[model samples]
Target: MTGRPNDWLLRQLPYGMLSEDFFVRFVSIFQEQAGTLLQHADNLPYLADVDVTPPAMVRHMGEWLGMPGIDTSYPAATQRRILRTAAQTLQWRGTVRGLTHLLELYSGGPVHVTESGGVYREGAAPDDPAWAVLEVDSTGPLSESDFLALVLDEVPAHVQVEVRVAGRTVWPVLAEEGEMAS
Candidate 1:
């Protein structure tokens, strides 16, 4: 005959259990583990919801959205803000409004974005077309090349840009290596 492990144990159990009988024993263990597993499963859907999602998960969400210059060193709130507005930024991508918004978010400061398109003047326009200029404070996380590539990815391929970081201008597409993929 097989002897039960708890045969010699007392009938009553701790933590709200009535008894350590077969029915209660298996159910208690399964119940505890299952509740925890279910909680984790339920949270899977919320991982994409930036405001409520875990801080560490925010980076992965941003990456999944294909946003550039989401620096790992950035604070959790900043990461959340970036991830949250990624869709809005994507909607306005390539426009001056979009570029300015993106750069401001990245720098956590004001940005000036001036593009050459849509200008209507009475006199003849200059023979040489002027590229867009993005002026931002230089205190952000991205290196100059990375920032340049990020901007390039936003604009049309035909449009080149000049970036002035903290009043220092890097003229006419500073991507010595290459532009970052959009």
Candidate 2:
């Protein structure tokens, strides 16, 4: 996991742009982890192949990178491990309260962090699976560009929102999800 593109970075290309530092370092990490994933994939072989989903690959890389608690028995635990590793490396935690605050603005929804550190919108309970199962560690390390894409994808449009960062607030052009959901 030291010198190669891990599976997560490869999958994220379809999602949005990445900064040069992020892109380069992540690719290096990904490349370093690919061989380990291949070996481990042959061992337990969760997916049909090593390079399927971004999140899955990240988990695989975490296993090789020695990320703690990454091999949790629960699905949510596994997600959490991947997220935490990515967040720490990317320096995303500073934005947690900010992201939560932004969610409140957009949805007019209350926001709070779960005991495990995942964020939830107003009306979401601590036990809610969205918060419980999401494994929010990576949200901590996200770059401004990546964070914006996350907000656009993660936030529901029916709720009003205004995301603020670095003292600037932004009202995003919400996407249509109703038809898509149906």
Candidate 3:
């Protein structure tokens, strides 16, 4: 049987520092995983009124409300506003941080992160204030296989976590396979 949407979403959580190439792969994987989760969660109730809009200053450049044209209709306007807010809330940084927070909670461990940006360390502490959200830890090295395994094991007993780690994602492992030092 397939895993529940909530369970699947929680398990595909992304964790660890990524190189430039690795980061790109992470983004791709995250989008895929999140898309799947959303698809499975389609039955959930959603507010009818929501819209996204851009600030007037940037209007000259033509802001895309995630569609082809300006949404002037009442429903469209509401959707635009909601979309903008949700977009901001689910920024790349926010999404990554959220995934990290989820990892910590699932692992029942304090995430120690070591990354370039302050965003990675956003709400990380021994006692995370955002318990329900994912936390990013930048302190230590995390292997891709282990990361994938962590996610795979967390899902409810049925669904499989199909993680496709790019060669660049686990460069060290590839290098070792190529007879390079460990």
Cα RMSD for candidates in order: 9.0, 20.5, 26.9
Q: Which portions of model 2 miss their true places by more than 4 Å? A: 1-42, 45-56, 59-80, 83-141, 173-182
Question: Highest lDDT, which number?
Answer: 1
Model 1 worst lDDT run, 10 consecutive residues: 1-10
Q: Which digits, one per residue and each the tens of the lDDT, describe model 3 over residues 1-182?
A: 23445434334544432335666565667777877767646533332223222333123222342222222342444435434443453333233353345355333346433322323465563343222211233212335555544443433332212222331233223454466433
How well is each residue in 1-182 modelled by candidate 2, as lDDT tens digits? 23434455555564454546687676768666776666665546554233344455656665554433233333654455444544444333224454555343323335443323445698674653332111122334345455556565444443333444543433343458623221
Best by TM-score: 1
RMSD of 1: 9.0
Q: Estimate each model's TM-score.
A: 0.69, 0.27, 0.21
Model 3's alpha-carbon lDDT is 0.38
Candidates 2 and 3, the one with greater TM-score: 2
In order, how many clashes per candidate? 0, 19, 20
Better of 2 and 3 by lDDT: 2
Error of 1 at 106 (Å): 1.1
Ranking by TM-score: 1, 2, 3
Q: Rate the local accuracy (lDDT) of all candidates.
A: 0.72, 0.46, 0.38
Residue-by-residue lDDT tens digits, candidate 1, 1-182 = 12323322323346455544676767667666755666688678886787888877887777777764467787888888888777678878778888888888777689987777766686777666656888998637777887777777877676767778889976564355776423
